[model samples]
Target: MEPRPPSEWEDRVRELARQFSYPPAPDLRSRIPRPGVRRPRGRRWAWAAGAFGAFMLALGILLASPARAGLLEFLQIGAVRIRLQPPPTPSKPAATPSPASGAIPETRMLGILDLAGETTLEAAQAQVPFPIRLPTYPPDLGRPDHVYLQGMGGPAVILVWRDPMRPDRIRLALFEIGPGALIEKITPQVLTATTVHGRPALWVEGPYLLQTRSGRWELRRLVEGHVLLWTEGEVTFRLETDLGMEEAVRIAESLSAP
Candidate 1:
């Protein structure tokens, strides 16, 4: 019969037999030395030791030099000098004021009326003269025809009007209404009516007042004369001339109301 299938043990035996053949040993021909071979005497370590000693000696010499110590000290001194310097200073500015409060002052009364009336009249009379010369009236008459005295004194022009029933009325009219013309520029103030000599009379503001038993005299200035007139109701009496306002007031205070 054909070769039967080999048993497992037989196959393993065959494989082992195949592997048992010895392989040829590697050739150990010539024993040659590698190029640049060195002996292990630790020469590299010795050279390293010598170089380290030389570096240490150089470092020690450099440290011992005065210049090196001086250079280090100079660096330290420069650092201290930089630290010691002061910083820059700043400038100051001017002050200003606020804008809330206003300006200007205040006042009271302004006109002449606010002053005392009698006092002002006295002041006015002191400055001027009265009972001045009357220029010839009715300027049409020829020279020296006839001289008739209309007014009481030299300069006062007393007017006489014909009224049979009121013959004495013309004399009474003088104090009530002055002459036809205002001779002096009289700045009139307040006027009040008073009873003098037991009759109605007017108290007009002027130089000042002299109310006496004789009559009421007022300081007045005509064109050329400064005179005092005693006015009692409708009657006017011419008194002393050339009197001042202050003097008139003084003279007035001395008299009694009549």
Candidate 2:
């Protein structure tokens, strides 16, 4: 291979380079002292950066998901939306109970609907879709004497059975749950699961605490005995009576469409 001749600007370029010598790079490594002294700070900064990156990644994942937005946890069913977590601690004290009614005053967050009325069985059945079941064990008991509708969470059928021996005595409050309703099982109530009519059922005995517009009402009016809860198809049934567990089970098993 033959050596090529230099260009016309080669000498000029070399002269210019020599006139203005390239400056040496500053020793950044020397400026940064021994690694031992700064090791803790570097580690802390590294950890902070890593944590920030992880948080950003997690936030991105949460935002990407359309199902869960923001921090509030919830269970959505049809038109109803229930919080999976208890509400945030209230900043203000709860409203005072009323004097005349002796019930918790109704508020935006709290509500109540007393459906106990002197209505006929046929009239109540005409309103809902599900077949209302009446206990067949005590045939003489026949149809419910008083019917009530729990019109709050969902359309639920409340059947009252007056004492056979004493017609004035209200003995039972049975209810049938409507479709897509959310049943919130709160504290202070003994919740047990048993089978009735070969179907899984939840039995609640003793007093249970609940929040209502009537303030906080401990539901123990006539439910001193126990409650038998069972679901048939999309509908859920609950029999609130002062009867024993065995009797409740027997009654639940004998539930037949009227």
TM-score of each: 0.16, 0.52
In TM-score terms, candidate 2 sits at 0.52
Across residues 1-258, which tens digit of lDDT does each residue of candidate 1 receive? 898997554454344334323234536354233588663444664554464334323322223443433332111010010111122232443232111111111222111112121222233223223331221322331122111222112123222222246442221112111232122212223222222222222233322221112232222222122333334322243322233433433333333343
What is the C-alpha lDDT profile of model 2 across 1-258, one tens digit per residue? 899886434543344334322236667686576656655775775664464344333333333443442453542222223233344555666554221112222222111143333356787678777777788876677877777654435566667777878765567767676885554432213544356664445556533223333444333334456667666666777777777778888887788864
Which stretches of model 2 miss by more than 4 angstroms?
1-89, 93-118, 206-221
On TM-score, the leading prediction is 2
lDDT of each: 0.27, 0.53
Error of 2 at 199 (Å): 2.2
- Residue 107 of model 2 has an lDDT of 23
CA shift of 215, model 1, Å: 28
Q: Give the Å shift of residue 38 in candidate 2.
A: 69
Clashing pairs in 2: 104-214, 104-215
